[model samples]
Target: MTKIEDVKLIEIPKVKDSRGNLAIIEKDSLPYPIKRVYYLYDVPSDAFRGGHSHIAQHEFLIPLSGSFDVIIDDATNKKTVTLNKPDKGLHIVPGIWRELENFSSGSVCLVLASDVFLESDYIRDYQDFKLSKSR
Candidate 1:
């Protein structure tokens, strides 16, 4: 499992103009490089998502529309980071559990992952995540 030092924050630059603001996340921009890109939205105020940890994947999350916070748990410690700007992204390394919450209305959470979709790579339980990371 990777350590806290492995995680980082990335910023996605937005080109602003009278027409519109455009920001892009490509494979070369991410720390570990991006293999897949996805997004989340329509989250309720009383709800949460991402109570899982990755075994061998890295992710970079950004709030492309409104705002949201990603609470990352490194097993021994936890860090809470809010992403509001479309140009800013938070990088989550492998072996860390993350929970995304407090999404503003009409917010878009974009994720850039280093690996393709693999259900076996995820550790969904907190205790199980910690134990698996220790091994």
Candidate 2:
């Protein structure tokens, strides 16, 4: 069982330059090896995404462009965080429900996943997630 308090923000080391800046993620930056990388973009301000919880997979979410809110719930408690920095990411463990919303214009969300896509690993129902937590 994982607690909502276990969720955290990971800071990616940024390299400063006169031209601009660069942030990189290496093995030392994450607890698991990333197997898949994806992104969300062009989302409407009124729309939301990710209303599911993973069974065994972990994910790291970063706001690559604008900003958005990530509402994470652990059946018993919930916490909302806003992401607007490219060098910071939210590290989410398994068995926590998450919702992405309040996206600013031209916002882009980058995700680094610990595993490849597996439908069986996802519990999409909020009620079902609650039941599982009760177990």
Q: Highest TM-score, which number?
A: 2
Off by over 4 Å in 2: none
Model 1, C-alpha of 29: deviation from truth (Å): 1.0
Tens-digit lDDT string for candidate 2 (1-135): 898998999999999999989999998789999999999999999999999999999999999999999999999999999999999999999999999999999999999999999999999999999999999
User: How does each model score on lDDT?
Assistant: 0.84, 0.96
lDDT of 1 by residue, 1-135 (tens): 566666677767667899988887665776687788899999986678899988889888888789888888878878888889888888888888899999999999988889999999998878898888677
In model 1, the runs with Cα more than 4 Å from the true position are none
Lowest summed-lDDT stretch of 10 residues in model 2?
1-10
